[model samples]
Target: IISVGALAGMFTMMVTMIYSSSRLIYAIGRDGLLPRWFGHVKGHLPENALWTVVLIIAIMGGLVPLTQLVNLVNIGTLIAFALVSIGIIPLRRHQAFNNEGFKVPGYPVTPIISFLFCLLLMTQLSVETWIMSLIWFAFGLVIYFSYGIRHGHVAEKRIE
Candidate 1:
């Protein structure tokens, strides 16, 4: 039963991650942050975006060892979560949006604790993982500045 549960959980995570990653690429392309080809659809599917994501994943999986991949994924997940937690503080401060449903109980305190915990966990990872994450982040920054910031829909709209 334990093995079965673990297998199910792993499959669920894999499927959800694939879907989410493909959609993210599609959204970015649609926003003009990436090549317009990435946003192209065929048969009601974001085929180009999905193919690009799959190819990237295949290359990464082929190049990196399984253990390193696990470490990278873990660090990436933690960092994303930490960013989300940190973002909530500023979002809560802004009164532009209506608060209709649930709100975080402790506001700043809760997010602060979460961010600290994520950082602590990140510190426990290997130096190689940290370096790799930083490199990827730098690459993202380069992409954003070189193409995303200028060609992005929001930026274009703001200019006009």
Candidate 2:
């Protein structure tokens, strides 16, 4: 029973990740970071992007070790959370949200502490994981600067 429950949970997580990643790839393709072929849709579904994501996921699963994959997910999650926490400062200053009723107890200090802790946690991860993440990020930067900056929808609109 426990094994079945764990398998079900893993399946759900995989499905959720696939859907989220496919949507992100679709949006990036739509914005011109990737070939428009990836953005092709059929009946409101990003089928091409979905296939791309699936292929990438399969490749990673086949090539990358399980431990490395776990570290990748952990590091990515921590980085995202830290960035979000740090972003709260600018967001509050800009009055991004209208939440006047309830408030965090520590305010600015809380987010700062959270960001610091995330950094500390990241230091515990393997250097290989960090290097792999950096390589992927650099690749993304290259794509964005090369294709996205020139052909993005926003850039096109700005020029018009």
Judged by TM-score, which candidate is best?
A: 1
lDDT agreement of model 2 with the native: 0.87
The ten-residue window of minimal lDDT in model 2 covers 151-160
How many backbone collisions does model 1 have? 0
Cα shift from native, residue 34, model 2 (Å): 2.4
TM-score of model number 2: 0.80
TM-score of each: 0.88, 0.80
* Count of steric clashes across candidates, in order: 0, 0
Model 2 misplacement above 4 A: 1-5, 95-106, 155-160
- What are the Cα lDDT values of the candidates? 0.86, 0.87
| Count of backbone collisions in candidate 2 | 0
lDDT of 2 by residue, 1-160 (tens): 9999999987997898899989989988887878898789999999999999899889999999989987887898899889988988776665545768646569989999999999999999999999999998899899888887887776533311
Give per-residue CA lDDT, model 1, range 59-96, as digits (tens): 99899997888898889999999999998887777777
